[model samples]
Target chain A: MNKKYNLAVVGTNFIVPRFIDAAERSGYFHLHSIVSRKTQSGLCFRSANGYDSDVVIHENIADMLNDDKVDVVYLASPNAIHFPQAAACIKAGKHVIVEKPMTSNTRELLSLIALAKANNVLLMDAMKSLLCPNFSILVDNLSRVGRIRQCTSTYSKISSRYQGYLDGNNPNTFNRMLSNGSVMDLGVYCIHPFVHLFGSPEQVHAYADLLDSGVDAAGIVILKYPQFHVNITHSKTCATTNSSEIQGEDGTIVIDNISTLTSLKFVDKKGEETEISAPQDPNSIFYIAQHLGETISSGLKESAVNTHALSTKVLTVLDEVRRQTGVRFPADDR
Target chain B: MNKKYNLAVVGTNFIVPRFIDAAERSGYFHLHSIVSRKTQSGLCFRSANGYDSDVVIHENIADMLNDDKVDVVYLASPNAIHFPQAAACIKAGKHVIVEKPMTSNTRELLSLIALAKANNVLLMDAMKSLLCPNFSILVDNLSRVGRIRQCTSTYSKISSRYQGYLDGNNPNTFNRMLSNGSVMDLGVYCIHPFVHLFGSPEQVHAYADLLDSGVDAAGIVILKYPQFHVNITHSKTCATTNSSEIQGEDGTIVIDNISTLTSLKFVDKKGEETEISAPQDPNSIFYIAQHLGETISSGLKESAVNTHALSTKVLTVLDEVRRQTGVRFPADDR
Candidate 1:
C-alpha cells in the first residue's frame, strides 16, 4: 500500500477554496491543518470544516513550521512576503508549495533553490497550468501544426475593485508597493505556455501602460525565439476575448481560455477547421494536488512538474520587464 | 481646371504596375516618363501601357530629374537602393514617393528629409495602410471601446520564393545584405498602426532568429509607451492567421487581417459578442493612390499621410531590432 500524504493548508482567501475542494476529491491526500494570521478567522474556517478545536492555527509562521503535526508548509502570503516566508520554510527543512508569482525577484528564488538543495527538501512554484494533462497534450501536438510563425495570448479580467480605486479606496491588488499589477497577477498564464513551448526567449521587450497608483494596470510583452515569436497581453483594469492563437506555417491552433484548456480548434492553411474536445478530471486543480501527494508519500525531494530552473527563468523575465517599465515594489527596494 | 502633376515611374517590377495603373486612374496626374536600368525593360513597360513612344527613357537618374517634365519621382527600387535614389530626387526639387522600409536607417531618412526641405518638394513614405479608410475608422472608434490596455498585431504571408530558397535558391528577399527580410517586408505593417496610434515607444527591445543569410526570417518587436504596450510579430519564412486584436478594459476589437482590414468583431465581457462588418473596398490599394493625387493637387511640399518623421521613427525601430539581433544589411555600412 502507498504511504498516505497529509498537507497543511495555508492562506484562506480567493483561490484557496478551490485548492481545498480539489484536495478533498484527490483520494491520495489528507488536509492536516489550516493556518492564517487572524485566529478568529482561522478558527471559523476550521470549525466550518469540522476540524478539531485544537487544530493548529499559527499567527506566527515560524511556530507553525516547528510544530511536529505539520509535515509541509504552503505559503500564500502577499506578493511582498512570499520571499521571506518561503525562504524561512526552506530553512526549516520543510517541503513547500507556494502560490503563483512565487517570489517577487529572481535572486531570492535562486537563494531558496540553494537552501532547498542543502536541506534535501522539495520546493515548487504552484504553476498549476503546466501540470494539466490537457496542456501536456497541447505540448505534444505543437509539432503537428508545423513551424510556428507567431503567437498571441491574452488573459485579461476586468476588476470591479478599480471602481473602488476610482471612488477613493485602494485595493491592495492595484498597489505598486505590494508588487500588485496586471502582469504579475494575470500575465503568468501567458508566460507559462510560452516558456513551456519555447525555452527562454532570446530577447524580451515590454510595453506597459500604468494605472494612477503606479502599477501596471495593463501591458503587453514580446518574446522572440529562434524560429518564431510570442506576444503576451494581460490586464486587470480591462477585459478581453481571453483566447490564444498559435499560427504556424501549415495550420493554426486556437484555445478558448488560459485555464481549463477546454476548447481547442485546429485550422489549416486552406481555411478548413477541426475541433477537438476531451473530458477533464472532475476538478480542474487535480493535477497539482495529485503531484503534491505523490511527492510527499514517496519521500521525494522535488517535483518534475515545477522545476527550479523554469521558475527562475520565468522570474528573471518578470523582473526584467518590471525593471524596464519602472514598476518598483517595496520589496524591490529592499 | 486642376493642376496637372507630372510623375516619373522608376523600376519595372511588381509594384511598378500598380503605380502606373493608379497614376493613370488619377485625373490630376500625368505619367511623364518611366526610367529603368535596362532600356529594353523600360521601353517594354512604356509600350505595353501605350505611353507616348517619343517619351525619353534615361539610364541616368540625374539627367532624368533635370528634365522639366518630371515634377515628382516614384521610387520602387530594391531595398538597398532607396536611400541614395530618394536623396537624389529630393535634391533635384522633385516631390518623391518611396515604397516601404523607407531608407533602411533613420539617418538616411533624416538626410532625405533635409534635402526635401532644402528643395521644397513633397516626400512621402507611401505607407498606404495608414491612409486607408478602415484604419481611419479604427482610430476614430478607438476611444469609444474604453481605455486600450494592449494591442497585438501580426502580419505574415507564405512566400513561394522562400520555399524556393529553402530548396536551394538565392532569393533577394532572404538576402541580408539587401535589407530584405520579413520585418521590413511584412512587419512594417505591424508597426505602422502602433505608431499611428500611440506615437513612438520610449524604448524598444527586439529579438529575431536569423536565417542562414543573416536576415531576420521572423521576429518580434515590443514598443513601450507610457500607458499601454504594443506587441508586433512578423515573418516571411512561414505563414500565419495574419490578424490583430485591439483590447481595452471593457471589450476587445478583433480584426481579421490588418493588410486588407477585411473583417472585424467586437467582443465584450460576459462573453457577449457583436459582429461588426464594414463594406470592403474593391481596391484595398486605393489609399496610397488617392493620397498621391490629393498631395499633388494641394501643391503640398510634404504629406502628413506618410510623413518623413513617421518614416524615420519606423526605420529607427527596424534598425534597433536588427542591431540587437545582429542582422546586418549592406546599407548599414554606408
Candidate 2:
C-alpha cells in the first residue's frame, strides 16, 4: 500500500500558490496547511488554489510546527528565515523540502542537516531543475560532446519591483537585510546547474555592480575547475536572453532556461542541431514533490538526486562568492 | 584628386593573404610588396593571391620600410615582434596598420603612438569589428536600449591545432613564451568590442584555467563600470556559440560573431524583434583598409573611429586582466 504524505508550507509569497498546486497535483502528497504571518491571506490563498476547507491556516511558525498531521514542511520563505524555520520543522521530526539557497550560509545549512539526521527525516533542497526529466538526458548525453571544456549559464530578469527600487523604494529582492541580492535570488539558478554538472570548483572569482543598498544588482562569477571553466552571470536590474551553453570538445548543449530544463538543443562540431526533450509535467515543482514523497515513503532520510553533499558544495561556493563580492546579511554575524 | 596608398605587408602567415585581398578589393589601396622570413614563400603568396608581378618580395622589415613606394606598413607578425616592427615602421615615416594585440602591453603601444605622432603617420590597430558598418549601427542603437545594465561577449573557437598541443606540441597560439594565450589570440575580439562600446572599465577582474604550457586555455573577464557590468569569456580549447548580448533598460542588441559583426538583432521590452543589418563588403577587413586609406590621405596621424586612445584603453584592460590571471610572456619583462 502506498503511503500518502501530508504537506505543510511556510511562507505565502508568489511561490506558495505554486507549491500548493504542485502538492495537489502529485497524487502521493496532500496540501494540508500553510504558515503565513497573515492568516486571512493564507486562508484566501488556500481557497483560491482549490485546497479543501479543512486545510489549516497557521498565523505563525510555532503553530504550524506543532501540528502533528504535517509530515513534510515545504519552506519557500525569505533567505534570512530559512535556517530557523527549517530547523524548527526538523526538530519537530518533519521531513523538509526547503527552497533554493536553503539558508543564508553553509553553516546554517549544515546545522539543519544535522538536526534532520538526528530526527531521521528527509531534508532536500528544492532544486527543481535536477528533478526535471531532461536533466538526466543532459548528463547522459554529455559524453557525446567529448571532454567538457567550458560552460556558461545566464539567468537574468528585470524584477517587476526593480523600477520601484530605482525610484528609491526598498524591495526585499534588493535588500541586503532580507538576505536577498542578485546572487541569492538569481545566481543560485546558475550556480546549481554548474555545480550539478561539475562538482566543487577549485577556485571562485566574483565581481559585481552594487546597488545603492550595497547588494549586488548584477554580477559575474567564474568557477575554475581542473580542466574546464564555468561563467555564471545573474542580475535583477536587467533581463537576459536566458540561455546557457555547455561546450565539450565534440559538441555543445544549449539550454533555454536554467530555471526550467524544458528546451534543450545539442550542436555538434559539424554544426548539426538536434533538439533533446524529455516527458514531464509543466509544473517542475510537481516532480520534486513526487520525488520527496517516494523518498520518505521508502524510509530514506536524503534524496539521491539532490543530495546533501551537493547542496553543501553549492552553498559553500555561494558563501565564498558572497564573501568575495561583499554581500553580507544579518545572519552572517552569527 | 584621390591619393592612392601603396601597402607593404610584413610577415606571410594566414592573415597576410587576407590583407592582400582587402587591399586589392579597395580601389584606394595597392598591394605593392610583401616581407617574409622565407622570401620564396612571400613570392609564392603574392603570386597565389593575384598580386601584380612587379610586387617586391623583401626578406626583412628594414628593406620593406626602406621602400619609398610603401606608404603604409601592414604588420602581421608574431605577438612578441609587433612592438619593434611597428616601431621601426613608424620611425621610417610610414603609416602602419598593426594586427590585434597591437603590442604586448599598453606601454609599448603608447610608445608606438608617440613615434607615429613624431613621424606624422597614421597608425591604426586592425580590429576589424570596429570598422564593420554594423558596429556603427549598434553604437547608434544604444540609446534605444536605454541605460545599459549588462553585456556579455563570447568568442571561442577550438583551435584546429589544439589536439597537437594536447599531444605535446607547443604551438605558437598556446606557447606563453611567444606571448600567446587565449586572451591575446581570441579574447582580443571580445575585449575590443567591449572597449569600443563602453570606453575603459573602472575595474577588471579575471579568472583563467591555465594549461600545462602556463597559458590561459580559457577564461572569463569581468569589466566593471559605474552603472553596469560586462562579462567577456574566451577560450582556445573549446568552441562557443560566438554571440554577444548588450542589455539595457528598454531593449537588447544581440550580435553574431563579434569578430565579424555580421548579424545583429534588436529586441525591445515589448519582445518585438528587429533585425538590423548594415551593408558591408564580404571581406570585413576591406572596411578598415578603406578607413585607414582615407585617414592617411587626409593627413591625419590616427583614425577617429579606431583611435589610438581606444586601442590604448583596450590594451590597458587586457594587460590588467593578464596581470590578474598570471599570464606572463617574455615580452612583459622587457
Q: Write the per-residue lDDT of candidate 2 for residues B294-327, one digit (tens) a residue.
A: 7877878889888889999999988998998899
Clash totals for all candidate models = 4, 0
The top-ranked prediction according to lDDT is: 2
List TM-scores of chain B, every candidate.
0.92, 0.96
Candidate 2 residue B83 Cα shift, in angstroms, is: 2.1
Candidate 1, what DockQ? 0.35
lDDT, candidates in the order shown:
0.77, 0.85
After superposition, candidate 2 runs with Cα above 4 Å error:
A167-169, B167-169
TM-score (chain B) for model 1? 0.92
Tens digit per residue, CA lDDT, model 1, B253-322: 7777776677677777555777674675556556676788788778787786677777888898888888
Q: Ten residues in a row with the worst lDDT in model 2 chain B?
A: B19-28
Candidate 1 chain A has its poorest 10 consecutive residues by lDDT at A1-10
Please give the interface root mean square deviation for model 1, in Å. 2.8
Angstrom error of the Cα, residue B19, model 1: value is: 4.5
Tens digit per residue, CA lDDT, model 2, A1-334: 4667888998878887787777767777888888888988888887777778998999988898888998999999888989988888888888889998899999999998989889888899898888888888888888888887789998877888888898888987788887898888888888987887778888888877788898888888888888777898888877776478898778788888888888888988777889986766888888888788788888899998899999999999989989998888899998
